[model samples]
Target: MPVLDKFNMVSQGAAGNLCWACVGWSVARYYDNRAGVPPRWSTLCEYVMKAADFLDGISPESTRCCDGERLLDPDCNQSRILPDAFRVSSNQGSVRERALSFQEIKTEIDAGRPVGVEVESSSAGSRAIAIYGYDDSESQKVMVGDPAPDAPDGALIPYDELCFGYRHSDATWNHSYLTVP
Candidate 1:
């Protein structure tokens, strides 16, 4: 399986509304790994914030979160808005359809791709995170890159715990995950 190199987790800092920072970091890490370069976490975060507004057609507010549907829109103007260097081909689906299953997540990881998942967060309400690795040993877990200020980078969360968060009924988008191709 391919593991992301030169990847580092970053804090969302004072921008509490930018939960999509995880998504940005995941996409940035994917491109950085492909280019075999060191991570540019802050720069990528800037681009991600702009891209989110373009995709969602609204600037993120303190009380609102970015929409997953808009981010995964295949026909959106990603090419026009995102720098050519940051552009990527992707696929997405709903958790209710088994699209975010453990096998599917592992498949992406094995292919050197990161998966962006929407999950419920007690600390920040609804949140997004990137899943970059899977461990199937006695204690199965998925490696995650989270942007919450208090979250640690490369946290190896149990698969079941991730599932609970991803499938949490109270989350803003209880169904979506965007996958890199």
Candidate 2:
């Protein structure tokens, strides 16, 4: 389970990819051990959005409208999604505050679970990343699978910086993140 690399590494391939929901399903699939050849990027994006439809009582097809960089209004309720295998849920709290502790995140990663996190993006709105492992040597950082990566292996965010960035304040909810179950 050390730095679980079997999880599918994906890049948001289109201008309107839903990073929030994409990472949600990605972590879920990874936890379920279903990291085979993934569906097309667009198809997987749509699937994740549909899986999150129970939150807003919306049709699966209607999620296509959520094409912006930010998460959909009210955000995708991670608890509402009934993943084919795992029982998915989020850290209970509003998106405006910190939802998980570093140890909580590390515990999941130690179990070979990938957790989803939302961070402010320099390009568009906030972006989502799938965190796989932690490095607590000289500097503390987490190995992440950033869908918006400019290159491979994604990138690493300093643990403190990641905690700060996860606290977001926008027109929508303040704190928004999805955790691996």
Candidate 3:
């Protein structure tokens, strides 16, 4: 009956029906609420991501401060108003290694399910994102991305390449845990 409940239901689905966008919005919402983590949704289409906006909206200060790449420090040294999840991992493998991996991402992909990518790499400009969907079965290249109209450019990357930036190979973000009360 609630958005979080709906998100939980969708997350529980067999891999093909995961609905990653909802998951992304929900998880980001959770982090924003619980840990004061900033929103990772596209700035270009902030209005469209209403739920995420509600969790962490863009403003002049938050904009320069909260960008996904910059939020990695839990202390948020750069940002005067620090977010909780920012420095939670600190170069360690993502907390996600307990579950979610290439094989798991593949299962979700084969089923047309959505997956969330929680990667943090200086090479990647230091940011985390929610992969909308992926095509891991492709022979040479696997496609992973979100469909948000205003997402950043150059979003897609080879599936094999996606795992390195993260702290864990098996971490998949779950949004139901992210609802804003």
Query: Top model by TM-score, which number?
Result: 1
Write model 1 residue lDDT over 1-181, tens digit each, in one string: 3356545555655455555644655576666667777655435444454555545554644212224422323222232311222332233322342336677777777766676666654654666677778888667688888877778888887777777654353433244454443
Off by over 4 Å in 2: 34-42, 45-49, 52-96, 99-101, 121-124, 149-151, 164-181
Q: What local lDDT does model 1 show for residue 42?
A: 38
Alpha-carbon lDDT, every model: 0.55, 0.52, 0.33
Q: Write the residue-wise lDDT of candidate 2 on 2-119 in tens digits.
A: 5776666566555334455556556655644543544333444354555555454667665553454434543432322212212222422223244356676677777666665555
Higher-scoring candidate on lDDT, 1 or 3:
1
Which tens-of-lDDT digit does each residue in 12-70 have in candidate 3? 11222113333344444444444455545443123123323343453434443234433
How are the candidates ranked when ordered by TM-score, highest leading?
1, 2, 3
Clashing pairs in 2: 95-174, 95-175, 96-174, 96-175
TM-score of 2: 0.58
RMSD of each: 8.7, 7.3, 12.8
Where does model 3 exceed 4 Å of error?
A: 1-23, 26-95, 110-112, 123-125, 136-140, 146-156, 165-181
Model 3, position 146: C-alpha lDDT score: 33
In model 1, where is the ten-residue run with the lowest total lDDT?
Answer: 76-85
